[model samples]
Target: MTGAAPATIVFGAVYATVVGLCVGSFLNVVAWRLPRGESIVRPRSRCPHCSASIAARDNVPLLSFVILRGRCRTCGESIAWRYPAVEAGSGVLWLASWLVFGPTFDGLLAAVFCSLMLVLAIIDASHLLLPDPLTWGGIGVGLAGSFAVSWTTPRDALFGAAVGAGGLLLLIGLWYLLRRVRGMGLGDVKMLAAVGAFLGVGGTLLTLFLASLIGALAGLLLMVRGRLGWSSRLPFGVFLAMGAVVSLFFGPRLIAAYASLL
Candidate 1:
């Protein structure tokens, strides 16, 4: 591995941890407010338990979490540990993607995509709802990133985005017609469009298939543990995000293997 050298590994890990910590701070804002139908910008981050304004110094991502011992300074109320975990997790994923794809435009775009997925996973798990702004805004960002990177023709990207969104919408509609219920939400439809815009047709299909597989496994596990009934709703968006990430790293190989199998 190019990252085999001790110095290189150390530098990469440190850089990743720092960036992850900072991004995680912003993610916390998105998590807390998005579901409440509130803008994430107007009100500054405050302690949820005590409502004390957190100082800049005390908001130093992982460092602050550690220094404060995951508690509010004013109320001594313990903060959720997920804060640092998300920040640190995002950083590591971004750094690893950077290393794998190099410093190319695709690498940067992939990092952004992965970060959105991290947010999606966290928010969906917490509330079982994927925010439209994140998914729809991501489509725009992915399209812009594709153009910046010259990864695909503009026509291809546009068509893929349309196909991704339309295809999912159609399926969602059909499911609704037969069952008279909501199946996949609009959030998933928009998210697929964003994924297709970035990954093209083949990758999008692979992502859907992989996501379905993962979702099934997760559902089965939950059912067996008696935590979920057959009718319980699961956040399939998390699995979709997971599938896209996997395909970003190994999509081409999977395509090749499928062709050989055929």
Candidate 2:
């Protein structure tokens, strides 16, 4: 959905960025806990080194990291840089959503879309596992949201889901038939299906194209650096997340530009 510009750029930008950072912080917890079969809500966020509950003051997104000097208060252990990076990245994404979609339902959808993609990207990159809760929950939310959003209809959303998963499944079959080895797992298939539910057919197709292109470039770079072999597996879901983010932001413009040429 294309949303009009926000009424006030300054307020909207600030609001989006702050909320986004907070969301990112929470997602960091989700990414760590969901895969490890831990409750994100039960135990408060703690320093891994000391198991000390992080104070509310110390959990204020990027500032906390800076104020703490990237160290645990209780133990003085170094914090992972990933935390602040995710917050900053998420802030940018949230600001981008506000700029692109304004403060409409469409904007909210964009933010949610970005959040799902970000957390999934982190999880997949770390564990090479896309948990069922996120993928399936995303599908449910996307399809349910289809009726409320202007950009996609329920039928198109369903069709997109089918195409996203079916296309990948077909490719998997072909890869195995030719190589006698799995190039990717079913998790990637399900992840794309979630993408499709939110984006519809054209968006999903474009996402796949962008992801393939980027993934190929990354793999080639890795190979050139002797850091990867053809047999090595890269987390396809991470690339998928990147592709979906691109698709969410610019796929419509790109599609329109291409169609004009056609």
Candidate 3:
């Protein structure tokens, strides 16, 4: 890493963080409306409790939430903490991406990928839904980005997508044949395809491994706590998002380490 001036790096980080926060705010809107099959652009943000239109000032991302003490200004109804949390988390992720990849094409791609994953993770966690707009759009972006970015080739992206989706389908089919029950949803397969498009085949495989490892741990914990049973479905998309993010940042090192071990 270049020993750039502290001020310059700080300025870049702040700029990226601000952009991420704005994107996060928009993502929150998308998450709320997409699952309901409502137009995200139409019927501007409103208080769910009182059905009052939100003013521009009251919708200023994290600032507005803090100013209002996490309540709707129009109705005084308590707002979900997820609003500010997502905004803050997005900002941190943007900052991290900028720091990792710097001001470059790869940095831009990482930031965009992180943003999409964050939004999808939140949607899946909250509503158990991963909309096509994000998954399919992500695959398109990944393929297009590979042309400009040096990390992966277009061929790798295509191969990754095919393998990711195909592997999941195979697993689902086998599980259904053996257990007469669905093992996973199409959304997960599509989401993995998107991740593979962005990260290529090796990264996609790593993502699946990491997601499964963490998800199994989480399920075991939940079961032990009596919060979940064997039949309870976990939001698998959230784990995939987590794995994608991890693989995005550390995949090269991880692959290199594994190769060394071998």
Candidate 4:
């Protein structure tokens, strides 16, 4: 059915919550293992302190955290608060997307996009790096999705990928020429391409602008408080993810506002 019936809606709500939380759990593994060049599947969830393999029953996403009192069963070591935080955050974001778009294709796309944002943000925050697998892979997925759902014409999607990749590369070159330093890393460049693949040229630009503004503000604040030096590195991927989220949810309105202001 194009629209969910009442019973279907109830089922969907429950399923979305459960699935979102479970995905969040997987995402946590991905975030932690990817940077280390380790397979997420190789080692099952274990206690960080004691290396005790977790029982399946104790891996039930948010419930497990509550039940275990956020401690490792074998060692009684406290679990990082981030585990539940990411789980709940992803679940809520997925639920919000479902509420906004229903069970339609748009909802599914938005959900995947949001999940990607979580992965991107986590990796970036941890290592100041964005993996090509996630970035370029996201671009491919977004482009394929655009065609599956007819969100963009094949021509637009192709052009978007080209413009997205090219535009950022050009900016990086210019920045290097001006400063003799790397202003944008290759990871960020790949990320912009991925953003373009999903958002098209206009949406990609909006994402860049929004990310820059947020990153600049945050950096300035840190500098003002003497918490960061002029040369201190900032997490660019986090800003990029935020920009993508803002563009995904409010690009059209923001574009209209910009036009009006101009």
Candidate 5:
């Protein structure tokens, strides 16, 4: 499909980025509350250190962090930089989605996919937990987007979900048999299934390969820093989310390049 004019694209990207920043603020709530089994809506974002309610002015995504100097206004406790970082990262991802897919339904779907991946990545990295709401909800959204957008057919999305979950399940079983321990969590399997629903089998496979490559690199880095050992657990979901984002943007070109090389 033809893209929009340069001016229109620029405007759309900016608009999407702004909306993403707001969404990222809410995502912070989701990542924090969901793992704790708390209601994200009712609590209204209090400082974890002092239990002071955040004012509306203090909750303006990246801007608030800057204004507050990354400290709680009430108690001066240091706020995590991850809050503003997620907001900025989400804005960038939204801008990238609009740039790649243009101002179309596909662009909206891409933005939503990226947002979900971001939330999953953050939760997994911090808590080593991937909640069902994000994973299962993402699967539903991905399947709906499959029919709504031109990225993949429904059949391919279905196959992708099945293979993504099934492949991981098999690997986990094998690991258990060989090591007498569960190597992968069900959350990772479900998250992959959700990714497959969006990306199809080829993209899912590419995500797995990319996740493995990056995860190994990260593990090596941790080991070198004396932070990890052979028995240390690494959060695989974060790498999977990263790989899915990369595949979302570049899977087609990457697959084509590999095919040409073959």
Candidate 6:
């Protein structure tokens, strides 16, 4: 609005970035611990190498990593680069959401989507496993968020969930019928369901298209490098996260562009 002050906007942007970085730190803990059935809330963050409880000063996200020279203060063990990278990436994503979507419920939802996508991508890439709690919990939160945001209504969210999960479920069933083996993990179906809950049917479809294309190209590249075989399994959820995040921010434009080409 013309009445909005530049200073206010700047403050909001800074606040969002700070919050994102903090949340990113928590997300890292979740990615590392949730898969192992550890309580994320309990026991403070510790060094994976030395099991020394990290001090609050050393837990300050990106700054701490740099301050500590990327080594554990207790054991001199090297810290993973992903820690600071996630924090930086998350801050950027939050800033992008604020700039692009503005300070509104839509922006908040966008930020949340980015957060979920980040952790999901990290977990899937590292473990090749997508935990049910996250997928299921994400779906519930996304559906709830729809009532607050203008874009996706309750009916649309439900339809989207069906379309996203149903499409994958069908493929899973067909693969089982034909090959007598599970072709994909149920985690994927649930993940898409969560995506659909936030994005709606069209966005869900767009995400699928983008993830498939990207995954295929990646697979081909790996095959060429002799790192992947025909029977090799790719962590598909990571690509899905990439696609969903792209769709969340740019789906309408991409969809229109594709339609024009057809």
Candidate 1 local lDDT, 10-31, one digit each (tens): 6766675567667777888898
User: How far in Å is the alpha carbon of 228 misplaced in model 3?
Assistant: 1.5
Q: What are the models' TM-scores? A: 0.88, 0.96, 0.96, 0.92, 0.95, 0.95
Ranking by lDDT: 2, 5, 6, 3, 4, 1
**Candidate 6 structure quality by residue, lDDT tens digits, 63-175:** 99999999999999899999999999899889888887888999999999999989999999999898998899889998999898877898898899989999889977997
Considering TM-score, which of the candidate structures 4 and 5 is the better prediction for this target?
5
User: Which 10 consecutive residues of model 2 have the lowest summed lDDT?
Assistant: 1-10
Residue 228 C-alpha lDDT in model 5 = 90
- Please give, for residues 1-262, the per-residue lDDT of candidate 3 as tens digits: 3898999998998999999899889888988888889998998899999999999999897999989998988789999988889889888888888999999999989999999899999999988888998999999999999888878999999999998999888878997889887757999999999999998999899999999899999999999999997667899999999999999999999989999998
Show where candidate 1 strays beyond 4 Å. 1-13, 177-180
Winner of 1 and 2 under TM-score: 2
- Predict model 2's lDDT versus the native: 0.92
> Which segments of candidate 3 are over 4 A away from where they belong?
1-3
- Write candidate 2's Cα lDDT for 85-184 as tens digits: 9999899999899888877788899899999999999999999999999999988998988888878889988998999999999988998999887888
lDDT of each: 0.81, 0.92, 0.91, 0.84, 0.91, 0.91
Model 5, residue 152: distance off in Å is 0.3
Give the Cα-based TM-score of candidate 3 against the true structure.
0.96
Candidate 3 backbone collisions, by pair: none
Q: Give the per-residue Cα lDDT of candidate 5 at 234.
A: 83
> Which lDDT value does model 2 have at 234?
95
Using alpha carbons, what is the TM-score of model 2?
0.96
Candidate 4 lDDT over 1-262, as tens digits, reads 4655888887888888778898899999899889989998977887778989988998889998999999987889999999999999889878877876778887888888889988889999989999988998988887888776534555676677778678778977987788776766889888878877777777788888899899899999999999997557788889989998888778889999999999
Candidate 2 Cα misplacement greater than 4 A, ranges: 1-7
After superposition of all CA atoms, the RMSD between model 1 and the true structure is 2.6
